[model samples]
Target chain A: MEEVASKVLSTKPTLFSYFRSSASWRVRLVLALKGIEFTYQAVNITKDGGAQQYSEDYAKMNPMNRVPALFIDGKCLGESIAIIEYLEETRPDTRKVFPSDPYLRAKARQLTEIINSGIQPLQNLEVLNKIEDELKGDRKEWAQHFIKKGMNAFEEIIKETRGKYCIGDEVSIADVCLIPQCFAAERFGVDLATFPNIKEIRDSLTGLPEFIAGDLKSQPDYVA
Target chain B: MEEVASKVLSTKPTLFSYFRSSASWRVRLVLALKGIEFTYQAVNITKDGGAQQYSEDYAKMNPMNRVPALFIDGKCLGESIAIIEYLEETRPDTRKVFPSDPYLRAKARQLTEIINSGIQPLQNLEVLNKIEDELKGDRKEWAQHFIKKGMNAFEEIIKETRGKYCIGDEVSIADVCLIPQCFAAERFGVDLATFPNIKEIRDSLTGLPEFIAGDLKSQPDYVA
Candidate 1:
């Protein structure tokens, strides 16, 4: 089934992505959930002396020099949230990733923004590199401090708004954001048990076929 | 006309805010644009020895312990983005701050998120305070560096997507975000002339009645 999905997706639109990138993981989950076929064009950001920076072609596709650029119907869109939303709008026949009620949609978007803004940038590879190179701090300790702070905030946010999903009983864009952040948190040894709400949401999300298939460990380039 | 709008709005809701906060400024712009009346319940975050730390009542409304919490129709919403979006949804008849097309809407939101997540947090008071007290840096220099970096990125983003507005010819949520951030940038003396697109948008936005009313100088607590 996994092979078939990959093959079919490969024949459709293509996503230029890195397997380990949380932003790319978000777009992948949306594609899987929507059941939309799309090709995964892997650009290993870590290899060949940083593929994203060295590739002239990729830079043209995304001037911001970020991963998870999508090429659909010959037009390219950068920024993971923008790409996901484009997919959501273009393929409305698939499951709706955003809620219908404007207020609820805003709530869902707010949750996604919190993770995107509050947590991800703080622990991004570039920022961590700065801490190690310029600040002269133990990389592990700095990463641990931010990851813990972010997760604590995530726990509070989840407790306030979650139900069967991040906003309520429905899986919206918020869930797509939650999973990857959780993956990053666990890698930093932040202890998922401390955030029961986040753990429960992660558990529920992992059980879904879409999420399971989108897992970094399940990707073609999975190292470990 | 401005007085009447303010009077009508003042009767509709109450906002818990800090005078110098960009997040608070974002909500204030939304309220003014929507023509909603509200009272400003000032929480001088820095006055008389850190008032926000002692405001347990405010914490109940927002577990995140952030400012610009809105109480509307007896319901409280935290997060400035969340509150502005809620107002847009609940009062769609007033004025539509979000675009109807999903792609455009997503693009506008992407700009908003980039500022909210990518730029704002890097220059936030809390983060700057941490850098000063804990990292032992010149607070003024550190603030200027981060604010300039964030604004430069923002200028590039605006140049790419902007039309008559941040996303297009219409004023959307992105403008609400842009105004406050520009104000913050000016406060840090980052030289707006360096960013022509941002300068143009700022010029256009300041001419509008709603934005003018939301200006920090026009607020009830304006020092000048």
Candidate 2:
């Protein structure tokens, strides 16, 4: 590692996050599950037109200006799945986010990508606002429409795949992604009742300590 | 593997794809780069409101009902990134989509995720239709806005990282993703001049035979 990179990793790494952002919540759960210590910097994405994230200073760390940028090993990494994979690789001795078998590992990733790429981005706050403002659509209704489509697919896959969690009896990265997405889906008024298979797996995951501590209401930046 | 899945794999693997989908193009590049021969089954995304993909038979094969679903190794995998990773893992001895070094591998995935999750979903035909029909916004304008934002970030990051590809001298997954996205962006009227580094790298990759054969026009489903 470069001297600068080594030094940053040596310190308590900093995580830039928002309290209610599903992407940010996924990262927080990863940090907690891996038992990594980190400082939290709240970038108020909903304030001043989400100005804090787009500021000149913040853009230096993350050009996309998205939250959940983790600074570690001398690099500022953006994208939640990217950051999660980095943590998993660099610290393999820690709790794992994947299975050991390549096929099973691939299956885990397939489930995670279904959310990370498939569902979560569609209902993101920025997209929500764009539709609400430019199209005069109800933001909550727009969110519900997309989330339900995602959950409907998720229900089919998870039914065949779930044992104790999204993959099996163990918690993997897929569960980390599922919890927050399920939370956001319910927040937008999509009844979890629509997805029986997913809701059962989600119910089992929500009570764990790692998940409990990462709850949106428990985060430092949460106002309500 | 199940007996039926094994039988399916015994035949040439099938790619469930669309002629113009950028996500499908990424998978085609990976298949060609690995020298893996596959049969193509086009699921037209623009016909009957994308009804073919959602039909009972197609959904049985892929619950997600998205194109670029790969039938290989006795499994049907949806989501482009997941299929790519599966190919990389199942055939590690083949051409890789990631770097051997862990940190660099993480970086490659970050770039791929930026396109897979960031730009593509926002400009999805479904999302665009929702905006146009419900919000009275121009679909092309919505696509241009999000594509430009993603390309701006991609340009900045690739400037610091590119050599022959999106990482360094070697071709990586990031390159696989960037080439198609740049094409889609240009089609939607985002000027490539604004993203010089990305455009330069994109130009280099497009010349490769692996990419050339996967061009939208080369696919059997292409109209022109």
lDDT (tens digit, per residue) of candidate 2 on A1-224? 12323434557888888999888899999998999988777889999998889988788778999998888877789999999999998998899988777767777887888888888887888888887887677889888877877778888887877898988788988899999998888788888988888888889988999998777878899998
Best by TM-score: 2
User: In angstroms, how far off is A116's CA in candidate 1?
Assistant: 1.4
The share of true interface contacts that also appear in candidate 1 amounts to 0.40
Model 2: colliding residue pairs: A5-A74, A135-B135
Q: Which digits, one per residue and each the tens of the lDDT, describe model 1 over residues A97-137?
A: 98887756766766776677667777677656655675565
Candidate 1: which stretches are off by over 4 Å? A1-11, A47-59, A101-103, A139-146, B1-11, B48-54, B138-153
Candidate 1 per-residue C-alpha lDDT over B1-224 given as tens digits, one digit per residue, 9 for 90 to 100: 12223432444688877767888888988898889888887667666555563466665655556677777755667778778878876886887888887766776766676677667776777666755676665556655765666566566666767898787778888899988888877777778898888889889888899998888777776664
Interface RMSD of each: 2.8, 1.2
Worst 10 residues of 2 chain B by lDDT: B1-10
